[model samples]
Target: MHYAFDADQETFRRELATFAQKVLAPHYQPDDRAGRMRPELPREMASMGLTGLRVPERFGGQEADAVTTGLAAEEVSRADINACYILLVAALNADILVGNASEEQLARWLPPIADGSALSALVLTEPEHGSDAANLSLRAQPDGAGWRLTGEKTSISMGMLADTGIVFARTGGSGARGVSAFYVDLHDDRISRTALDDHGGRAIGRASLHFDSVPVGRDELIGQEGAGFVSVMQGFDYSRAVIGLMCVGIAEAALDDALDYARTREAFGGPIGRNQGVAFPLVEQATRLAGARHICYEALWRKDQGLDHTVAANMAKWFAPKTAGEVVHQALLTFGHAGWGSDSPQGQRLRDVMAFEIADGTAQVAKLVVARHLLGRKFAP
Candidate 1:
């Protein structure tokens, strides 16, 4: 029944919004042109504790709850959706590590991320096996007392600049059981990176990472050998909802601009917003965005309360980005000509929001998860 943010949460959300507008919004369009994150971007966001939102205080982090983390995604993405990618990957990695890593492992691995000395990537996808991550071919050959990884991971967000990555590789027989997670130093000479020029989110430095005999000792093992898939997958249920919020944030920003245009721009000697044609589509999109936001927050809240949120999370994953894309497209149309320009956020917002529909699994895959949860596994797709 509670529909509003608590006093503290509201205050925090406002502070984040202000920071996003002042520090991140200015770079939103420009960074997309630069095709890489700025040197100070990591540390600046770290200073705000955004890069460490999910880490425990002992690790120099805020240990923020899932809802708080979702709020950060929503607020930050409104100004710069690409900047939110850093927080997204960081939160996912922190959650996975905290849930699975040994105490010693946590002690060593968590600090650098919390302190902004490290930027993290979840290395789960390969070119051949994306949604079917269980079938990934990246091999982690057993060495003396460790393993040597040799394979390629493409479509990696932050791969170009990440100092650390939790790479999942095949270690045993076929399928998911064969995979294990390794916390690897991406800066090592054994690893070579090819930066991807993405359609959007270029600021996050998406890339392909190739590992040729990269060493991973026993200490770098994240959890029990075969548990990596489950650990990482569990984190996704929550991160999906966070991504929904991020997608909604940019759409909301675009909507705001469209509304502004409708109010001031004259058409037929009157404000265009006065016409139902211009206003109704915006209204419909607004309603859809509102519903998506609620679902996203509900998923995050369920995770915070120790409830099974898979259904809500997947629903948000599929619904939010799709809704956002529609909303941004409608908003662009509202501008008529101004929105088509590269200078306008509408075009960039549309491109950026498009990625969420595909990243973290496509809408079709997310719907399939919800169907499986709603119907019995045998009865579902």
Candidate 2:
């Protein structure tokens, strides 16, 4: 099977890598320190069409395929991990809106996101329901022709700053079947936000959203009343693979630094890389990350070809970030105390990669999915 990128994809990769280094890398640390996204970043990314890579052409987007979108995710995260979340969260939410929203709803919301006039975030995980999203307690009660939503969602990326967001709330009975999705304006008076000072990926700004009496009309409800869980859960299969690529990018960056240091730094009249002890672990990590990258792209390619990719996606999700964390740790140790300093991005890379281990789904949860898919759910965990 062909493994290399096509000519156009290669060109896209080179250009995006240059853009990330020249633009994103410079502001990454400052923005992280400030715990906020740069005000101009969203519009800048939109100008590059990065924000709407997966959005449809009718909505002013390039309508990139899943493989291309995954490639862009890897390059972007390689330069600045936190900024990658903007693309990830937006693309997932855009897909949801495209797939489920009515024609008028898509017309209204898609343009703003496509043109970079607005930023979007997904509101799913609540304090009480991290992995148990199907049982989220957020309440949306019918009020005449609309619904009034009231609940708190925590650990949401870009929750405090998104101009718009998609929220899942309970509208029927209990569990997954009762959940429904709503499109809401973050600026509504009934909505209040509090940003969290996370250890890493601070620019993405995880936050808690308290929605009290937020009014949404019937038009705001996406798809049928209880189909929202299925809609969003389907998106996760794609997102998990993309997240794997993102982590691989971070790990590659860290390993590159360590390799550079090993080749140049001398100890006892020789370069440290000359020692197998210093070099073998790096070799192992390189091998692991390469496999992870292949699986991630393979999963995306399968998705583009309308093939079943659940097993590949979950495998990548389970392995990539875990490998990334291990590689980054080794890289830090290879730096020989230089990596421990706050001045070194290696530490930040470590903290950032740690989030992916739990973000989209934990390794345990991902394994469970793979297990269930391989064996029938009746016999699987």
Q: lDDT for each of the candidates? A: 0.93, 0.90
Best by TM-score: 1
Error of 2 at 118 (Å): 1.2
Assess the local accuracy of residue 81 in candidate 2 as a C-alpha lDDT between 0 and 100: 81
The C-alpha TM-scores of every prediction are 0.99, 0.98
- Per-residue error for 365 in candidate 1, Å, reads 1.3
lDDT of 1 by residue, 1-381 (tens): 887888988999999999999999999999888777888988888988899999999988989999999999999999999999989999999999999999889999888898788999989889999989989999999999999999999999888899999999998889888899999999999999998878888888678999999989999998999888888889899899999999999999999999999999998999999999999999999999999999999999999899999999999999999999999999999999988988888998998999999898889889889989888788664
Backbone atom clashes (below 3 Å) for every candidate: 0, 0
RMSD of 1: 0.9
Best by lDDT: 1
Error of 2 at 295 (Å): 0.9
Clashing residue pairs for model 1: none
